[model samples]
Target: MHRIFEFDDIIRAVLQHVESSATDLVNVAMTCSRLAGPALDILWSRQSSLARLIMCLPQDTWEGKVEGCCRDYIVRLSREPTPIEWEHLRANASRVRRLVSIDGFTDAPKLPRGPVLRRRTDGIGSALDLFRPILRPDVIGHVLKRLFEQFPPATLFPNLCELHFEAVFGLLERSSKFWLLRQFISPGLQALRFDITGIPTHEVEQLFAALPTEAHGLRQLSVSAGNGTAALTVPPSLGKLPKLIRLAIFAIDVSLTRQMITNIQQARCLQTLKLNLCGTSCDASGIPLELPSLKTLYLSEGSLSQCTHFLRQVTTRQLSRINISYRGSASPAEVTAFVESLSTSCQTFEHLERIYVVDKSDHPDYLLVIPLHSEIFRPLFKFKRLSSVKFIGIGNFELDDRFLKDVPIAWPSIQELKFISWKRRAFYSVTFTAMMSLAFRCRSLQTLHLTVDATQSTTIPRAPDGTEALWPTQTALRNLHLGYSRVSKVARVPYFLAEVFPTLWSFKFYERYLRNCAADIDLRLALEKAHSQLGALRNSPYENSDKLWENDSDDSGT
Candidate 1:
């Protein structure tokens, strides 16, 4: 018994690294009765599919194995498929705490939606594949209904904590499906993820309305319109989930934004909200929604101004993190206005921690420059608590050294910083002293990414006594990625970088030159090899290895 417990501990350790750990535990359960109970308990704790578990039953349980179809199915019902003789399933059913429905992949040349797909099983495999639940829409609906009917009760999975269904709305919205679902809406259920693609808005609304009132423990709900333009209707019942904490909506029509906002406003304990292409129609009312507990909000792909408009309506003073992304070309003025509005609204948030701004425009000719030194970005500097900031521009954006010098004062807590520009030259050359000033001030800085010119010849920054100015050594910085600007001496660049960031274990020089030059190519390759060598040297405990540095220089032929 002690050995069994010890082996169970090993299984727990293995589970942390592998998603198939439950399956592995199940295999171990088959070895002995002593191990079976505990192993099965863990194995059946979270099930991605009920069919997969059902298939584990003996061949006798299968009604009749017929050959023609890709997979097998229960043609005849026996004893209404009760919990008799199936000891393994009956014993472990109570352990199934999660149910996730797998999504189907339509192959090339999508078949027009109809019964035409049910007749064509030319390349479809056998019934054993039903566990994956990826079948013709009609077949999926039928099999799921049959399986749900055969499912025992909440007693089988008494502690089910989460229910996740992906692209399985056909089965979920079936007239009889709610009765089966009601069995699993135990008080222990804390999360619900439903992806209702192609399902009409009315059906989705009905599904939400059917949710059990006893869902007090439910804290997280993520729903997305699967793959189509179906604007999912937000059921007022969503606002009624007592402990609801996080909500995410994706690819929903703009027309429903008003109802969605109202639904979110009612969730008392909501902490995180994510909107991805969720709205089309912008609400002109700009009504304020009070959400004191909300801490994080992410917006992507929707109308940039509309998203900001929604943000303007929220009074989440405790909000700490904000991520906003625009997929298409957005005017700089509009983007700047959004930032300015956010900065003004959250000016009093002393706990603001991270801000990530991304412009995902694909147009090469378009460039959106943000002058950090100008009044447009002045409001952003008010967040003194910022730890991580990422600015990914649409094309190119200039970042002057004068503006960078104040980064430490603006966000002294900054640890991870990324400024990505798509232009050939986006950052003006800064004296090594000015760059080191940032390192000196921001002691906790670990990851830094920027692009700049390094080719200009200038006097080394020194003190009045003519001694080279020294900055405090930054021990936390481990990764540095700098855009390759022209360097007067290519060989000296790495040494300069090594001096600036002595603790770096990963250093990458990125140069985006339109027309590639052979000498430039050679220089980059050599620098890459040198960076690897430096990384290895830094990782090594033995520091006094002049021979290793010599060997690296020799290899680079410098």
Candidate 2:
């Protein structure tokens, strides 16, 4: 035996690499007496379903049958398994650290909306087929509940720590799934993701209220309710969890939002919060809610006023990221108010790094015409540490070269800056000069998306010595997306880009806007030529390729 295998930590570490492949882990386990326990322990640590553990019981204890019009394979419990037969299950059950209950029929044929028909089969089939069959969640729940009646329930899965209970389809009975989930909620459980899409609102409330008592050590919890379902209320008992750090809830109403904020006020350890507000208004009656340790916040499915109202009432100095998505058109005043709320509510702006605001409304006429001025975005300029700023489908921005110049100065560490509008503006004042400003100023920038008027001729800035002011390689920008930006001198554009942003490799444009336009066609061809040249240069063995920018002055029309 090798000395490396003598160390249990080393053995476990080696097994971690092959844990994803069950066959490899099983082979390792059976390879030798020394590797068996650790290999099996690694194999059973995380389980997607309860099918495998149940199959470990005596061969006669349960049987696999292929029945019903859909021809679904299912495992059915025969007589109750005695204590001797339960040993195999108990051994593996003790190793389980995470159990996720997704729908059993995820890959199965979509049957007509009706109860699944079941037919018992004679206990005879291919050994490989009978080895493991998809166990119906409801049947497994029933069998497990029956087994718990005979064996000690508390000791079933002693090491289980994480449980994700998600059932989108209505195949599993509410009672059975909940019962099975409840049995896994031990004091040591750290994370729980409960997607109660089909579960009744009252039942969801009841289960949420019982979580703190059932799993006091829970550090992360996510609850999601389906759209059009009854609104879910946040139970006060959930706030009692001492170590809760992250919480995300979907499809909640205004009243429940207030309740959630009020309940989690003193949860000082809470770091991340995501809420999908369902109501149009989320006014918290002027009373401010403070979360001292919160670092990230995601607000979606609310109106502009509702999201702003919610933001104004919260104070978290440690906030680093905020994502807000709302429906309907937002006026300049509304956008200003939302940005102002962030500037005021967050006492310190140094920690704030990312801000993403997107409009979900689909009406192009109503959404596209709203013009947002640079003054409306001035409030965010104070956050010096801002790295990523993304605004999608909100409205058209009247940005120019001057505003682009100030952006890099304001947010020097900015990496990803996107201003994506759903509709293309007929005319844009921003020219390639704005692009040059970003390439020269923002050193950390990796992704840039803007609508610039490339049709107009603009001179590249020159240094005092009369050379083109270029960062040839310093600029980290790799992806540049020109969104409906008009371009006429396509042949000169690519070479100019190579001179300014040598590292830029991915360039994208809205092709729909290119229909029947000569300039658009030229622009597309120019980009393809640049990509081909870059590919050839990268594949070449030359140490220094001067030909990269040799065609910088190419005037030949595409």
Candidate 3:
């Protein structure tokens, strides 16, 4: 004879199991058919604090397919309802707040009149004769216009701290009361990202003017322009925002940036600024180089000459972080000149090493009159305090002897380094083992990321030596991201844990480089296993949950 555990005891154990595992309950179910029912029940029956119930409103089934899933769940709950079921459905109101974001405009909810009417002859028991008349788009539009006309002292949605909208609503020549985008910023928003592509300039100006100072005084504002400079303008009212801090704008004309920064500087709280110029020219009026409080600044996809010139004007005394992307031919003299201009406070802050220049600028595009290995970075190695450096589009420059030898000189105080290239693709002549051995000598290296276009190699490289020590290390090296399999030697990730460096914290061992792909259960399990293995090193503990981001579309297609 056998005795069954109490239902409460079973639930407690299941909850504990779900909590401890850095994986999904669905993955746990897939491990064993016997565990499937209970594990799925745990995952589905439990409602997320922020989203809906997985069992009742299956995320996959939310897009108007199977019209009455919610009704079905109601039936199931009413029939065999357990204690957990009740807790999921009613206890969490946020989980049940259905979001029906419009593609081009806005609309409000209509009151429900019991079950949905299916028959044509369904009589005077209609939705029209409801407890109160439900407002339609036009009605709400008129009412909101009158309300805004009044200009009340306060608004609602106090809990609304962030508003990240991606300009899904196509623009019109004029603003409509129906387009109550302002209302969306319930409480004063702290963070806002606007995808203002294809919007007319006057409309942008109108909206900017209409927005109240306190309503969306966003501390962090990222504007991605699809059309061009027309989407961005430094509103006069922006200067009055109390807590505007971080600003990140992408795909806008660089000329518009100066006005935006001028407006930002008026706000005493502005700190971090990032400007992304994907395809536009950097001839924008010019960055306001004299920001008193600005500390961290990132300018990507601009000519390095422009960057170096811009930094020369700015006072880098308080600046801590600076990231510049390669866009033009910047010579070794130019890079070293900029480094030489850096305040001693910015450089030797941690007192590590001499400063240096690492220029892998390939061109006709200016073909190297001076070889990349010798003329460029070698002289700058004398001043080694500069720790960080980046190289792009250099597939042929594998960890060759000359290439490998340059690393020690370029990054003397280097603690963090990232290399994304096609290493295995072009390094056929260089033996993989020797290259690996050379890379292991960097004594001060810590976060290292090397991703190859593994699509270049058929399999891992098998050298005369048993295996390439891909992750060889003896220093405090931590955080390894070796993706796209460079060689056919190791069956799996090599020296990823303490064997490489003891203090390694974060590690990403991606099998395939697929972005926004449908998540597979096995792949998720493997990722969780790899993520959890960081505990073997002295790393931060990770929790078992998907990083749910609030994407622009209400539909979770991507």
Question: How high is each candidate's TM-score?
Answer: 0.75, 0.81, 0.47
* Candidate 1 lDDT trough over 10 residues, lowest sum: 549-558
Alpha-carbon error at 230 in model 3, in Å? 5.7
Full-model lDDT for every candidate: 0.57, 0.67, 0.42
Residue runs of model 3 more than 4 Å from their true location after superposition: 1-63, 66-156, 167-178, 197-203, 209-212, 227-231, 256-260, 278-288, 326-388, 394-413, 418-444, 447-475, 478-558
Error of 3 at 435 (Å): 8.5
Task: Write candidate 2's Cα lDDT for 4-80 as tens digits.
Answer: 78888888888877765655666666556678778667656666555556666665777766666665445568877
- lDDT by residue for model 1 over 401-459, one digit each (tens)? 77677889999899987765545345454543455566657899987766555554433
Pairs clashing within candidate 2: none
> Which ranges in model 1 have alpha carbons more than 4 Å from their true place?
3-35, 60-87, 101-143, 152-155, 167-184, 196-203, 210-212, 252-259, 278-281, 285-287, 361-375, 422-433, 457-466, 511-513, 517-558
lDDT at position 5, candidate 1: 52
The candidate with the higher lDDT, 1 or 3, is 1
Query: Candidate 1's error at 201, in angstroms?
Result: 5.2
| lDDT (Cα) of model 2 | 0.67
